[model samples]
Target: MDQVTKIANRLADVGGVVAVCLGGSRARGTHTPDSDFDLGLYYRPPLDTSALRVLAAELTGGAVEVTEPGGWGAWVDGGGWLTVDGARIDWIYRDLDRVYRIWQQCKAGLFEVGTQAGHPLGVYSHSYAGEVAMGRILADPTNELAALQEQIQASYPQPLRDSLVAHARWEVPFTLSLARKGVTRGDAFYIAGCLFRVAGLLAHALHAQAGCWVLNEKGAVQAAGQLPTAPANFSARAHALFGALGATPDELATAINDADQLAADVLDNLSPG
Candidate 1:
């Protein structure tokens, strides 16, 4: 069986695990084979502090770190956090009641979870909420995306609308998927960079639509939507990265392929079934 299935089975075997859900890029159908399995395991009541620590050690080979769940409210670096077969496996612990509520919201296409990664990390609504809502609006393909595209285009000055669509198509899916699974990979820094660009673009549109100011890479203030703020010094960094991305598209493709291969290798070794 696949590594994903293996993780799922292992999680199920654990006492108190109430439900297991596979999320992230794979579940979203946008994963490029290199993506890792983001397995979220909901346990009855909730794992105690000691249990959380033990699980983390077991998963990370004594290197699995633990971070207390603060504002976002989901325990991170808890047990079940490990790197297996070059793919990161994050075992997020959520109370069964909360998990059921999240599942209900997910099914209703709410796309908002209370806290991700078993921490107080709530879902960034502005990020994926628009995408999910837009997906529904454009479900008919009756010029729905186009209509929104036009509205955004006319409302925004230049490049912002096009950029948002581009990101909404490519970048946002990856971000939302990662956020969904509570697993993130920084092997390619560009993932974060791409998201930075998306935020800038969204801010631009939101500013035009709602009339607000957004901080940009250069700190040159611009009218952007009330979207999330861009990274402080991202603009200067993006130039080189874009050039690198263009030059190494194949390398990026290979990297993703390598991740998938690694996940496969681990799965082969573990043999879920």
Candidate 2:
């Protein structure tokens, strides 16, 4: 860990970079051997990407796919995919300006689900609060993460919980309705997509009940499965939801009915199931 911290600190030493931190399952100590190294470099606005670009070009040996700030998406900002010493390393760019705004929004009882591509979970950006609050700090010359974590965890604000629960309550049923319609239309693909949305919303509700914050859909189920409201035999439910049976549309009608029941259960509960 010390060695990794030194590497992260060196990366933070890059011009315009304020700090570098570890993220994802590795940071949480839940990583598999195949997990990619998730590193995020936080920077203030008007950041110069030139140094980062050159470093990336050198690190990945001219196979760099770095993007400018906000090029990937608003909340995620930007970063790069690089291979160093034959290991998969994900270099993420975090705009401190945006992070601060999102953090403030969280404090002020504001949050929204990201409908942008790759975020099918519709997670609230303020959930980045988790990344900042719970994530391990690697480098903080100016103590940026310490202050950020303090502010983020200042309280387990009820409003944030209320907001997530409310969103999940509505979204789950709504998406399930779409899934039912897809079943009637014999649209297996549409039904499958809706199931993903259903699970995502259920995960949101579960997290909210536990007063937990979520950043992405990655490992959402594993995070939520331990909660009380997690469905019975969650692995089987998830497998069925994702079509482990490869159910045809006619077969999906039963799945859709089961899905509706799942949504109803989640909605009726004071806490997630």
Candidate 3:
């Protein structure tokens, strides 16, 4: 159908490729005109790393920038837009069996119900489950928001669902601000990671409210009180981290506003103090 899919199929036809999976906003159907296709190339065991690298380099028409491995397998950025008969294409490659399972699962399920059966999905990722969990916590049968939360609540829970209300309301805004700053400063990886992290937080915040969980100002405040203190020396590093993310004051305000609304809505559904 699409050029990316065609290329993937072609690549799969190559001898060593075990499977070719798609990912990113494009795969999720949230792509804009400029979004590039993100593909994960999983090869059978005993892959010739050099050979694969050579093929990718040749295919991409630009140098490959490899992300440091996070234990399983390395992630490589395939630069250059591949033009097949005048159509532009850009993509990334992850070593087979080395990708994050949650990403794979979500990508697989994008087109159909049973698409993600054997792969890992964001089911266990706190970022993915955060908002949904929060919505569940604030269940109110009469409210429209409550109904929406109820719709997705059965699917999954945040990694730390009970603790999300407090953390998400504060941390998400902070992290979002930090992430934008990182993006501005060219800390793309940090920005991407923080964005995903905040998404999970928002998900939890929404779920807690919809589920009518123990989510109230008192509970939230208590959760805030329980936050682990950062060491004094780390304060500077923390600020630098924020700086790296290019966290802006305005962006922080927006995050805070969104988090607050989600929090207030959940609070409204509460059955009094």
TM-score of each: 0.36, 0.87, 0.39
Predicted candidate 2 versus true structure: per-residue lDDT over 215-255, tens digit per residue: 78887877777778676665456656665525567688887
Residue 200 error, candidate 3, Å: 6.9
lDDT of 1 by residue, 135-196 (tens): 21211113433353344224322233233333334443454344323223333555434334
TM-score of 1: 0.36
- Local distance difference test, each candidate: 0.40, 0.74, 0.41
Query: Which has the higher lDDT value, candidate number 1 or candidate number 3?
Result: 3
Of the candidates shown, which would achieve the greatest TM-score relative to the real structure?
2
Which candidate tops lDDT? 2
Candidate 3, residue 106: Cα displacement in angstroms equals 13
For lDDT, candidate 1 versus 2, the one ahead is 2
